[model samples]
Target: MGGVVIAKFLCMAKARKEYEAIVTCTMGCAFFGAPFKGSEMAKVALLYSSVFGNDAYESLLSFMRTETNDTLDEVVSDFMEIREKLVPKIELFCAYEEVPTDVAYAERMVNSPKMSSLTQHKFFRAGAKKLMEVGFSGLPGTHFVTKESAVLPGTHTIGLTVGHADLIRFESITSEKFVPVKMALTSMVQTARINARKRTSGQNLLSHKFVNQVRRSLEGVDMRQKFRAKVEQRQTTSWLTSEPQYQQWMAIGDSAKPLRSPHMWLKGGPGLGKTNASLAAIHTIGQTQLQEQQTESAGRNETFLAYFLCERSSGYDTAEDVLKNLITQLIDQEESLAQHARWFVPNPGYRGAASDDSLRSDLDTPASGAKATATVDNLWQCLQDMIEDPIVSSIHVIISNFHLLDSGESTTALLVKLREDAFSTVATPRVNHRARWLITSRDDQHIRSHLTAKCIAVIDLENDREYGGKVKIARQKHAKDTVTKLRQTKKYSSDLASYIRNSIESQSEDEKWIDSLCLLLGAMPNNSSSLTIRKWLREMSRYSINRLVDHARDTILSQNEDLTLEIDELLQTLTIAYEPPTLADLAVLTEIEDIQQLTELVRKCSPVLQIGEVSEDRNKVIFGHPEFRDHLITLYHGDSEQRKRYHGSMAWRCFKYIEKSYDRGQNGDAKGMRSLALTERIIDDSNVLVMANEDEEPDDAGPQVKRPLSVARTQSSTSIDILAKDFQMLRVSFSTTTGTSGAEMKAYGANGSEIFRQ
Candidate 1:
């Protein structure tokens, strides 16, 4: 009788497997054609079990009827028995309850230095022994066990039980509420064991791999803290205006063409706030989703979200890493999705109503001339599964720095495929389909050309009313607020606001200066353009324009001659450079060695020179606005010989400072190095070296040039060496020619190159 019951159970398991195979094959052929056979089999099985009731299969039905006090323990033992006895014969379903606790324990054990050094195979062996001692030591007649659990209590639970038929209940615990906690626990334990084994199995496997994954999981907390800190710091002075352009973007998204395709593009200069606006939109969407979930009391398991910053400079010259990272992020959010999201693999054909042998043969068929077709087919199938899966019903993806995909050569093919796939999958009208795409990039012609063909809506930053229109008004109010706050802190005089106002009003009459400032502002990238305006005032030695105006008003009241001298000196200093100097650099140039005195001077001249935010690293300074640098450069031509003389010493000092501070390994120092280059040219053209080196010239009567022979010789040698090195580094060569037109330089790489005649 026992043998008969066992044989019957085996036969049932075999039949279930066959049914599953048939259903899977049919579904693979026509995914939406018919209901899965497995569902029908489950229904039939449930009905048959209801009628049997311990008559035809007493031993089998008796195990199903028995209930254990500890479901976790029972399920774990049963799952182990199924794994051993059902292999190559039957399929079993199991669940466990204390899975989280088991995983936590395993993680802790693996991280322990004393035990972690052991290989995963050895580690699992040891862990299994430890788990058996702790969880199954006292339990009578228990053979094997596995476990899993509810991540959140009262949500769900599952368990399995297997052993001697008389010792276990197989029928009584079949209610939906009766979770297989032991099976969940066992599964989690086994998962941990398998992970540990993989981590420690071979020379390629390093313990750090597990440690790093754990570390990555903790990164979100760190990122949140850092983001909060940045926001707080910026909030102190940084201001944001109500942007109508953002509303327009929302409108565009709302009115987006109802094709089955997904497309979006935000175009702007660096500082135009495209990224911020996009992020804001995404946040709004997420909040909306949260509200819907709250109102419906439905779980958010069906939603998928991912953001990718393609501007990050990884080694590859393509967006593959960015795409992969985005996918990985999405997968990590829902682990089950990871299995369905296949990459870099070709598809197998539809197995529709095919036998197991036929399906296997089709899958094994070699890819010859149909490689591309096979690949796309596989990808389409995978995508179909992902979209249809109940787990990932809605997906939203945001890719930043879309300009990175504009490279005409390397990324063209991949971008084409991605665009095709994106449009093909989403743009079409499909019931219950939900997906959205957002992309941000500079408004370059290349990007516009590619995206326009695909019918993507492009939002231009320059014309964005939200950011561009309200900037001035917002800045003025922000300035006022700043002054008010400073006064409240007792950090400055109460009259500071009026002083700054008067000073700015006075500058309104300087048309030339204002025009220079405007030009400078126009030159800045969208993101940093506002900073240009601030930089102008800082360079003008006006740390606080309010204070400067106050002092001017006071001077007018007293009729002081010092004001005249100060104004002249300030103008002279300001007009000497095409760019603004840092407070430290200015102090050194003016011989004002005292930091406090320099600060005071800057404050007094704030109307002309705006003081901006200071960098965390005190070695360098930033202007109130990058536009101010443009203004300074536009107003003064340091190139003039006389003007260069006034700035020579200061320029040389700046050059030395930049040389000392620069880190060649990283991106070059933008301000310092560029400023030094300008100054060096000024110093070089001023004839200062020629004059200085004249005394060291040989007494012999040569051409009687101002420059010493040795100095001229050294300069020529240095120039030749520099030219040679530059060519060598660039894998190019240069040749010089002398004709009636004078010296001409021609550069040649492996391919044809350019020529520069000087």
Candidate 2:
């Protein structure tokens, strides 16, 4: 079967374009059951020949013309009619069997009335059933047989009788005569695979790219040489003298001897050059040590160095996992060190042991002192060995993130022990001259408490004058660019900018207005917290500002007349809700009569509302900020009596809106129906309905008026019925009080009466 499929694929590939042309011509005739002309069948045969082999094409053509007794017109017409009826049915069966799988093809068939009905045929039904039985069902819940069609026991006749025979014969002839074509397809697939592999291999890893970019950026400047030259050339007039922070940094190594420390802490905020300084320090130390090692290696033959980042992951945050990663990366980078650190690998046999005995055994093995002792110990022990070595002792170990090293008590204890072990060697006369350690951290206290040695140095980054000035300049530049971009948007600050520019450009002899506007903007407290800004904006509308800051402030504030009452109503409703409400809920509460009006209100209030995107629901709605919601709530809740009176009016307005929506629905407006449904949903929600119940009592009694009893009864009954329906829709329950006794109403039928009350 696979061979046959492959053969067909190869034959299709050979004359794919020609076959497509023939298929296109036959599609309409096949779909309508119309007879094909003699030319049509000849065309199909010609395409088949071009696709398979020339000999087969000619043979089929000759057979069609000479073997059959029927006239070409009759034969061709019969083929078309058979194909017209059969091919569509076959396609319908294929659709039912596989559901097309391709969404585009399925959608086309579904949209076409003829194609949809063909799939409803008995043969297609049976095919679907067979497919389901074979565990190849396309979608669940779709029934194979319906009242209109029953499953029949047979392969799809259209495909088996018409399409299958021709396809099989074509494949058989092609495989027998087209060996070279089959090889070409195989070669093409292999070539694609090779190209894909090459493309993947050529892509650079992010870390390598970062390192190369940074290296290229620093290629010309040698930090150690530069620093030395700067120190040598320094008089009283250099930029270092002007920059206090630069002076402090350079002062650390100003003396003949390098600044000695048991540990170091560099503390600063983001973009303060702490990282750059640390990298430069490491680079200088490494280059100096490597050069010395190379000179000694000419006589002793050995090398030493290692560098690795603590934080690296393809995806997800792994900051806490940096320690283990750093160790693994270091091992991978240095082959000699890796061989010595085999003890770090967990023993396969000891699955869950907590003790380090298995690892200790691997590390404790004895060999020549020069090579065996080269194995890593605690950081301090490694430092001690470096100090002891005659030819290879001048090793400088640099470690960063000293604060992140020991997050827990146990790890902290281990780190303290390692530090103690290293410093113990400092007491030895020879050890002091052989090795050095550089550590960087934000907290000096954390390191100090552990080390207990006054030898460690703590550098406060803020004290660096040059670094501070650079940071200030960077921030100002960033703020300027941010303001520029904001102004360019024409939505945020563009209008304000235009107003400012126009006010200045069109200023009459009165220059006071322009000066006052700038003063007001400057004194506007842009530095105020975001919450303060929102509060200030809400209280200072155009009219309100006109009363406070004269006409200038009023002119700065823009308003649209269309937004007047709608915006006020929306704000009032939001104030009542006391929380950011979803659009559906807000529309209900506000008794918004028109969806378009509600949409416009939301757009107008965008600046004051602080709208946020809906997280779960894709439905159009905006959430106000929590503080803004709180402010509205305060306004609504301040006067309980007035609030109740306001709510009553709102509820009555909602009732009228619902009636209008229903009238619109009766008049055959789908929009009105949707609005009615939404209003009904809101009125039916327990929270809103409960509020309505509270405000149901009339404030003033008047003369009794005759009401339609039947109409009243109908509305009362229908209200309860709608409530019950909504409860069911929302999957909730309601409590009913019957003569001072309450019962839980769980389920209700279409009528107003409860069916399940417990």
Candidate 3:
């Protein structure tokens, strides 16, 4: 009991007239979660039992009654039985013992005594010692803490340890217990506050550096949030909800016998709910975590961690972006990580404590102008630390549409790194069994081979249930039932579902497609998100789909010279420009008029060509979908002559643009002529041009005759040179004094070489 607490009670008593009686107990009794005249330990022991009023107790009982022979469940039920036996522990609670932090009475506070700093300090030490005496059986070095153990409210654990020595010394005292304990208590607060502030400053120092690095990489990234929001924000009752894969994934949450695998690969084809599944997984995990957090007064240990969804059209398609953003979210979610951030601050010889200015120095650039930011290794180290943290049972990192990385080097390297994290056998992995990688991707060869090389676990939704027997019949029946349920809702119009299924050209993939189509059609029976439905509906409808596919077909196969300036330029432009090119960029690069011509060209290549603001400051024309882009790459890859012709077409566009510049002075004539001269010089060096020197003959009717020369330099992998040669006319219009045997023959070159014949 301390005078400081008595004053607080008196202050409160003045504000309220409900001070019927004063109750008091131990000064540091909040350690056992004790209340004034109440034992927290006894209360908790009773509540931890399956029969107790706690939500977790009830949850445990419900889980036990699920009737499972599963080893994990059996283990959990065994623990539940132990809890059941412990319900009798309630008998240990006393009606009037131990002090709650809330009601400190005058009797609890130190009374009259000779005031001295040293004597006051002694009482404060005993008070805190009493708190620790109740903590962990008070016997020290004998405790079983779960991996998911979290901080309870009003616990001064970290700061108390940092300033433990100072806590036992006091700057002031009153005449109580040889000296007043309240003065000592006041001294404890001042000292602890100083230590806590110092520790927080150091923690925030390291924390801000990590955050800045992550945010710098994600300057304007919003696609990840947008994609996650769409899926999570949608109605929960979808085809995905009822699926077995979803059920199996939920197994990740079973902590007693938690799934040991850190990585879960959700593989499927396009339109197979891979993205939707990622969203659903995030939502489900996050919701569960939030509920647990709400129910129990614990700090940042909630498990559904971070997710990154790759959308190629958005700037988020890059591997660097995904990794950085995921790390950022991890840091944001776990503020405790900041306390330990000094462990991950990349500065060499770091003492693990720094001031705000010292933090800037920690991440400062070197004299060589190289970055001092956290690298992959640093990020990896942080994740490893997070995994080792007991509060985090699992650090889940979900990535969707990994295939849309467009086979980038960043993508491949990132995948390999992720695979390493997934299956690292090191005693201390970046993320261990508790660290999960929930990924969704199409089963492309690159993805298959990369994952196979490392031997990771893959959950292919299409084959979630095998065929031929009870499984096959069940799946079929399930699919039919799903369709029936969906059909009852007006949202899943018969025309829409029929159109989607009937349009699929292959029958072998029908069962998988049927399930996917219906799942996508009616996410919920009636309350499927209007926004989601509208997006897919536009793409799923027969008319819009037909037009889109029609455009793709015409562009891929069109050889109509009339429509394409008799050149194969536009088609190649569509296939090869993997990076989006703005209309102005395309106009300049392709040498077409910027305004109407480029717009018309993109329109003609509709569906295949999508226009959007891909990057800041520039609107771009990019391929609408990853699958579509990959398909084009495959088509062009298979055909040799077609590829060469397109290459020639690309060069042709450049040549024609230079020619336009020369003829019309589009850019100043001097610059145009200089460009032309540069092209001719290259052509001359290549020595693959045709000479069109005139013969010793002159036209009988025309004043001057011109011959067009088409010449190409040898093949090149990067750049192709096309030259159209027309000799400059020398002023020799031979007005034939013409009766003399059909005019005399003459010849000339641009540099004037005249020839005569007898």
Pairs with backbone N, CA or C atoms under 3 Å apart (clashes), candidate 3: 1-108, 35-99, 35-100, 36-99, 36-100, 113-175, 176-179, 176-180, 238-523
Candidate 2 global TM-score: 0.26
Off by over 4 Å in 2: 1-258, 269-273, 279-334, 346-398, 404-406, 414-422, 425-436, 462-758
- lDDT per residue for candidate 3 within 1-758, as digits (tens), equals 12123324433443455651121111121121112221223322333342223565544333223233253333433422332332110011101111122212211333325433433686544643444444323323321211111112323322121121132344556423214235334434433333333334343555565544344433335544565445443333335555554455554343323444556787876545566667777777777777765742222234646877775432355565575567556656654554433433433324333232111222133211223333445455556665565446556678888887646555667777877765564344433466667778888887877676334567675665631233334345445555566657655566655543334332213244444444335433366655666566555444333233344546444833466551235544655542455676577456675568778766655545557643332367765444455455554444543443444344345444434433433444432232222222123354342222232344577553444222333321011111223212211211111001111112233343342110
lDDT for each residue of candidate 2 in 1-758, tens digit (9 for 90 to 100): 12222223333533477554343222111111111111123334444454445664575454333233254344433433333432221111110111112233334544578767776777655543443343223333332212112111221212212121122233552564234334434433433333332222233322343333222211211223323432342111222123433333232211213334434445554334344455555555445545644551221222233322221111001121222233333323222222223323333222223432111223233321212222223332433433354333234444444543323443355456546655665565532433344555545565557655555545554666745565445434433443354345433355554443443333311122222223333334345554553344334322221132333212333455545566656766665442235675566667675776677667655444434443332353432222233344344445534443454444445444434433243346443122112111123222232321221222357543322111101110011212312122211133221111111213333342334322
lDDT of 1 by residue, 94-188 (tens): 22322112333444655677865463466455655554454334333322222211111122233323322222234456553334444444444
Better of 1 and 3 by lDDT: 3
Q: What TM-score do all the candidates reach, one by one? A: 0.34, 0.26, 0.45
Better of 1 and 2 by TM-score: 1
Off by more than 4 A, model 1:
1-261, 281-300, 310-318, 335-390, 401-408, 411-418, 425-427, 430-434, 464-495, 498-758
lDDT, candidate 3, residue 597?
70
Candidate ranking (TM-score, best to worst): 3, 1, 2
Clashes of each: 75, 3, 9
User: Which of the numbered candidates is closest to the native, going by highest TM-score?
Assistant: 3
- Model 1 residue 491 CA deviation in Å: 3.0
Looking at model 2, how many pairs of residues clash? 3
